[model samples]
Target: MTGMVTQARPPRRDDGSSVQIGALVPLTRPGWIEAGHHLLAGLELAASDVNDAGGIGGRPLELVVRDTAADPQKAAAAVDELARLGVAALAGEYHSVVARAAATRADALGLPFLCSSSVLDALTDQPTDWVARLSPPQSRGWRIYADFLLGAGHSRIAVAAQPSVYWAAGTRILRDYVAPRGGTVIELDMSALTPAAVCDELAAHRATALLLLVGHPEPAVPIVTAVRRDQRLAETMIGAPAGQPEFAEWAALLGDDGAAVPFLRYLPERLTPLGEQVETALRERLAAAPSFVAYEGYDTVTVLADVLRSHGTDRARIAASWPSVAVEGTRGRIQFSRTPDISVWQWAGPPVQVVDRDPAEAEPGRFRVLHTG
Candidate 1:
């Protein structure tokens, strides 16, 4: 909801043939308007860049956006309409529930569904052939995160997540990743508990580290707030992949240093070469669009243009090319698998930085990423 997506901008091709690309994700979330606009900006940027360089086989690329409001049923209907309209291909669906629905329908219709967001690992192995994605499976994200933390000498970890279809699935992936490695499973799924309760459990459970898995739009505020206030919790921790800036913002509301403290972020690590540059530029160029999900939408269109350009007017060919359609985007380096109808981007680690710090700084000793608890 926090991500901005753009509508169909005016075409820039001399041939006047703007290849239509369908979007099946939600466009009506709180920050979505601006996120959508940013997405559109990124898409338009991709299109203009492509056309200026080569014009996608001499035909400019275009985007066809439709809102699904994060609902699977509505997402499917949107995909159906887009398919009927005969767009060259589709992009930008974030949720796994919606992604599966759209991917299934696309498989049935032989249309290309280039999923942009959704970290649910299950979406990676879904039984569909129409999905050519640029976002990696959610489960794949955990392994990198797990390894990253473990590599950094963080083995005694704890986990938390909100209570939604998205976070529930994320909880499973995180639990699986942390448990097998002999790490503590303090509050594996925090969806059922209050943030204060989670801190109590973490303190009582004696967890040495923290890992949060968030996916729902804005449910993390209270949870992070409680964690920051509760003396039972440790300061040094990491967060899940879904909510980036939002997580930091929420934590900041709890206290000044709540957001800025170092946490091992999963998504930033996977940023592509250009994504890293764009992320840097985006931070300076535009206000941080509320949710990190916005970038998924931004990357989806960038890759869609690549596939449509390679195979002219052929959906199946474009779908098949998912595996070969390689590009560097804001989310990361994207490459979809042909055999499984899944796209997994490479992961890269970004230095942990804080956002939404309190208006004033605390004394140097007040807050730090040390384990005083």
Candidate 2:
């Protein structure tokens, strides 16, 4: 029960007749618990719906949930245990590095994994068919974010980065995309500086925008507060390309200061009919509007259930079905294919948007689409 989290829904039969999918999510500290909750909600909802509609060839769809707590080693261990337990496939993980660990283990064990929300470009060192992803890669999303910054006239940008492969990759993507367009990237080492110090650096560097490549609430919230309060940095824009502000907790913690801070979200401007229905159900389930991460979670199961039905739980067959997948997800039509520089079968066209909570809105969750890519 230490690493094991809730099962989400009880199995239809106590005789162990359910089809199991090992779910890796960050449900505890150091992980973004709010995001995990949303992600799990979508996964559980989709599974419940699948069971209602004939139960994947008459066996209940079960999610054996484990809390990764945003640790890579923890994720790898969970993957190994799940593989040993004979899950047909693996799903769900929000952190990129954690998902990478899970992907690596799943590949080595020959367990098919449909990564839910992690967007790291290099999911595995070598290409493997055992793994696939539902989220857009960090490079593609972050490069779009960089374009947004440039179009908005923010040429000099500063990033307060944490020491992590995901954050480092995001920083590198921004730098690579923006440098040729007369933009400069300044890195603010969060380990060596305080939030106030970060604000001072933003002012001193004359950074028109400060992108938070750090974690939420602890440093990201404080950094936003410091920047918003500091008169010297009043003109500088605050951004979170990794989408800290996409959750309700960000607005709850930072309130007005959290507004207008642009962040990347993998949602389209208009939801499809299925997306609209899922949104309503997800809102009712979560009591808050679901982030794009929830959609990714829902889509993960949607794809896996299709594969399981067609391929009949054979691990190799499920992995092999990645290319021929053509399921209608809550988003758009979901399919997987090899993308250049990416090691897994990727959903290459998930909608990418730079959005922000409207400061003028009386409601907290109201978002304004600023840019799309």
Candidate 3:
């Protein structure tokens, strides 16, 4: 969590004998640091496991990590530097916008990038074999979330959204998906309103559900507190489709207030044999339950290691091998193909679940599976 570079073991041969995969992660402020920590934990853990299982053709798989700090320009620059450093492939990014920038640069450089946790539908403006993704796209996940909202009898929905490409795309996805089903999405620009003003708007609009299309711990935590304490909106549901409640920081900040806020998670009803083992290792590594992002990190390495073994460390071969990947990941059998509207070779079926912290359970990480898609 603290180091920029992480290696599974000392080099078996000379320092230059190992295969290096460039990792792009956000490890500082303004980024989701907690999510970044878990992501790095999974990536490093899998790298260690790959070494343990006789690394790619007996060469140690090393990770040369660079912190993006959630900045797209910074991430693009990191991709350029990593390419110059001779990394055969690139991996690991949480923010969708940052991943988009990194993916574009990686494609231009002809370096294969296996994106770990960015869910934006358009990872690139045009499809290319250079980029592939583990996480489901925003349109698929957010549309499932909208269906969960409509199924729960929440017809009138309000979104307190900040201005960003990711937030705007989520808002548009919810609006387009929900409008046809008699559900209305009312947008409240968070830049122009305080937490108290958001509550007032919710009450004025008579919204039954309020979605936080904003960042964590600032407006999101305060807005949840305001809406929870307000007597007028006691029955209103608070939702974060971006998976804010999956992290311990949200529960630590909001406590029971954070419970019951349904969010999107890409996990199955039960972990596969590989998944269960990785979960235990990740919990020990992270000192808490691993979020879905952690599993994404593990699977990204899992796929990349297999590719490196099969195709050597050549960048062109790695990019060409994405469609033929058939590794069994922690969650399920992982495979990549062209998904409709998604510009990357995507894992078409990473399990999507709408889960919330169960207030009934007095524990922090206890989540109730409300609905699955």
Candidate 4:
């Protein structure tokens, strides 16, 4: 059921015709399945909303999901499959590696792809006119993290990055941003290290802040908890740009230690009416707190539906129309940049905010915005 593409029965569409939007997600992957499910929840809700609004050109929008399982080769193959299946546009995929691979294939096939959650800077590096992204690339997003740390007067920092291209790219960006600002960055390869080892390394460096760029919150919970227990690094400012705030059990796993750890997300301080509506609907349907990927997935589909509505299902026309089209999504307005350096053809720094969970909140994932960039 998780990987299966589900659509509302007929009568939701006019003439029983549907324009399928292809979604590439991690449905069966160990660390990514939960995120994939949340993304699907958002997509389903958005599809329903579009259908209720009479659909795109009277044809209901349908999502055809293909599981990438966080594998690059599978992601590329899925893009080909989605194109062969005659999807109007493409979206989804949580991992940057998968997104990058899929985007290339989607672009090669002349299909329009809107990346929902990948943050690798190079995902938009190519001159592929057919691809665009809703998530801010790591290059732009890491600046927000760097600025936050420098602004908070913490110059001595340590980075614990997982062995993924997503985290590696972020580590590189953070180092580039910090060194020029008279700050020092100590790097730690967290692939095979234990929580105690990670703590010892940070403590030895007298690190005032720790930047966790891990792939999941599982490692982060123990590492952060253990580091906080050390007297030397007890007050170290812990921050993660790795979508930790999106996990429903983020707080439950991290406990009180997880409090005040800032993370990068596409959401803002205040939710618009539409954002609130989506939040409420997702809560009821999923019976769990929705993650940031859910919001991104919802907005990506909304934008895709709108684009199809205005320009029909012609991929070339839709890709061409993206520049001038201003999409109002869950996270304020969505606008793609034509600039070459700034994650080319991406929603130019789409209102990313650093938020943290308040330990007192009943729902742990209900993070409050601590900083905005």
Candidate 5:
């Protein structure tokens, strides 16, 4: 929990009328994309649920969505547009990149913002009430990961990856564990020009294990393929959980992994109790569904609806309710940090590290809980 502090804020009217809530985030990403949809679904359900149970101050709720493509620039633009529209607050962005952008965007415009999936621990690094993050932050998640690695006997580990915010953000987690205990760091480029160069680089580090943090579609294949083709590959290869989705495909293409690599994901079960329940509900609702982006879109709506229904149409009132609010969506507990703009500090909040999967059987639907650490 971040320290309580007062800050500048805006006032809202009490006309007992409906108001619009904005969600600026990427509607198109694998795995977590459905989170947005589930958010919306939960909100839509909450809207009806609330009205039936008696709406917030006797007024209905509405949610507006703006796609960010998980791109920071686009996210900022979306925020500007939403602010012009005069929505109550920012709610339900599942991606870290979009979440970070949401913070900056909300702060700049003095709009209240709430994050549904901004797990990047650096997001809450300052003092600002305009933005609050509902998802558990990443600090505890990193600590849990460090303990998991140490327990796994992965001492001589190497960190490798494509250049991405997710990858870049993850390096700090890896380094926290490695550098402190005298481990190796091998930065591999994901450029199309140097395929073999990537493999040789990791091998040169002479690490017993490697952790690859990759971006979309195929950036990780080259590094994995190179490692496999080379006989001198590290005995143990690991990767961030988000990068786990594509590894199975890449692993099959390379053939005969000899189990050299294990794509480790922070499992969903480890999220807050509510986060776990939300993940389960989502899987059950969209069992074997291809269009996961729908979930992301809907989830955003759900969280927004909850905030609007419970806190009236005031941005400050809604944001203030974040820390105590609950949304029964796909990822579970939606509690956020108070004055979340400075969420990066240890005082903010610690994100839950649900080990999505380990090396052996971490495929898309075949996730299993490793440890809650």
Candidate 6:
């Protein structure tokens, strides 16, 4: 089915009612199907747990799932459909393009929307009272990456930026952070350049580290492979901040070449007690390790449940109560940040870590924390 509405559990209360939360996920999109499944897995698990624990004032949580298809128009239409169905609040969207459009629709409809994984800094740039996010925005994530590179003593860096609003925001943040510190950032737009051409530019720059803000592995795999094969650039520290969630997929495509490459992720290398619990459940359910995206999805539902529990299931009340939310999430304590430099409704300064890929570990990414902030 393209979309489905599933209740968390059988209704147990005398009223025989359930509170509906809308989820706008990219279920059928070309590059996003796997990510969509993992995210839905997390949200389903959270809903099940909440319903099992007596639900929100005895009303079981029902998630109305819609396929956004990673398109802005589809995203808006999904929100409109959810609004017509009368959901109390809305959440779940991986693509920033879709989230931005969906959030606008949700705001206009007076429904509270929580972004699951979209990272465009502009998503929450303007003061919007209806939307909030559980993931760190692109600007904050890249700034953290810059701090990690500097801490590791890499001053000269080469940037392989893909042309997308998400990567552009990250590139701007990295440039602003590095250049002011007397560090050099050589940017190569990977949009039009061939893999061989990108390698030539990297050689010319001769930087100690390569920061790839590209969201996917199409260009990253070929570029990183070419650079690693080059004897001259073998020592360069290559990092792909945007491709962390897709690490396993990229690693399979890159083979041993993917080993030792660093990437950024919100989930720390070390899982908290709660984190371990969630991982165990996810692994048991999915028959595979959960991605950071899954953790964010779970946290998103839990946060909504929190607001609904205390402030009631009123849409306006949930939006009004978001700023004051402080729930213990799978990674750690989750809270929205209002800093001017970040997405206004974003989870401010979520701890990110630079992790290296190790082939021997059980996890596909085999992520080992190299640095944390």
Ten contiguous residues with the weakest lDDT in model 1: 364-373
- Residue-wise lDDT of candidate 2 within 99-205, one digit each (tens)? 99999999999999999999999999999999999999999999999999999999999999989999899888999989999999999999999999998898889
Who is ahead in TM-score, 1 or 6? 6
User: In candidate 4, what residue range of length 10 has the lowest lDDT sum?
Assistant: 6-15
- Best-to-worst order by lDDT is 3, 2, 4, 6, 1, 5
Compute the lDDT of residue 36 as modeled in candidate 4: 86
Give the lowest summed-lDDT range of ten residues in model 6.
243-252
C-alpha-based local distance difference test score of model 6 = 0.80
Q: Which stretches of candidate 3 lie over 4 Å from their true place?
A: 1-3, 14-16, 361-364
Best by lDDT: 3
Q: Candidate 5 lDDT, tens digit per residue, 101-167?
A: 7788787787877665556766644666566654445555555665666666766666656666766
Off by over 4 Å in 4: 1-3, 9-15, 360-366
Which segments of model 6 are wrong by more than 4 Å? 12-16, 359-365
Using TM-score as the measure, the top candidate is 3
> Which lDDT tens digits does candidate 1 get at residues 59-110?
6666666766667777777778888988878777655677777777777777
Looking at model 4, the pairs that clash are none
- The CA-based lDDT of model 3 is what? 0.93
TM-score-better candidate, 2 vs 4: 2
For lDDT, candidate 3 versus 4, the one ahead is 3
**Which ten residues in a row are the worst by lDDT in model 3?**
1-10
Relative to the true structure, candidate 5 reaches a TM of 0.72
How far does residue 34 in candidate 1 sit from its true spot (Å)?
Answer: 6.9
What TM-score does model 6 achieve against the real structure?
Answer: 0.91
Higher-TM-score candidate of 2 and 6: 2
Of the two candidates 1 and 4, the one with more favorable TM-score, higher being better, is 4
Error of 6 at 29 (Å): 3.2
